[model samples]
Target: MAAAAADEADDSWMIAQEWMVWWDRPSWYVTIVNTRIDSIHRRKREENEENERVEGERREKKRAGTRGEQGEGESRRTTGDRATWRRQVKRRR
Candidate 1:
């Protein structure tokens, strides 16, 4: 009975050591996740700034143009709109 108890204790100790070894290492998954999140945040910030600048320009154009159509409409259009319009035009022809 005492031998069996010793074996169980030994096994538990080995498991604890292994767990500690595994847990102590630097995790690539965590690093990758952090890097990806930071990259996404940076990209979103740049996109938001660009959008704000474009919106400011659009407002200025609206105020300045007497006929309300003198701005770069195609250049100011969103990427999705341009792609969708291209696809539709291609299909129509």
Candidate 2:
């Protein structure tokens, strides 16, 4: 793109004074600047869409036990559990 711009500037410019650059002129520079800004905007929109998709997946995983399973704790024993442990310990001794 710069090459094309340089070629166009070279063909159109007629420098009568020394050390003058027509490619640096606002008319030519703004076109390149606008093209770059359009590219940045496109990239930002793609990133935003990707982020939203990933966030939704994460939310679903948490709800369905794929991420963090809810109520997944060890069970508490009833009062009668002591009789079982006592019988086992007595056999071992």
Candidate 3:
């Protein structure tokens, strides 16, 4: 008798689950597809933004390095002494 009752309870639960799935079946496919597409687009946008940020940082660093090298060359030409160059380097630090 207890086994029979448990079986009946399980059947009822399965019927309820089936009913819920049937009710949502009409729009479930479209909803799932749209959700997946939206997630893909969001990830792609985030990745592109990250790449752009890294590229911008790389460009800035490159420009700063070029300017520093140019300035050092000009200073060395104008000063024409190792001691003066050392002092300038210390001052920059």
lDDT of 3 by residue, 44-90 (tens): 99999999999997766555554444432232233235557779899
Q: Per-model C-alpha lDDT, please?
A: 0.78, 0.66, 0.75
Candidates in order, TM-scores: namely 0.43, 0.42, 0.46
Report how far off residue 62 is in candidate 3 (Å): 0.7
Alpha carbon deviation, residue 2, candidate 2 (Å): 47
Candidate 1 local lDDT, 1-93, one digit each (tens): 999999999999999998898677689966886899999999999999999999998877755453334565424455565678889999999
* Residue 31 lDDT in candidate 1: 80
Runs in model 2 deviating more than 4 A are 1-24, 66-93
Best by TM-score: 3
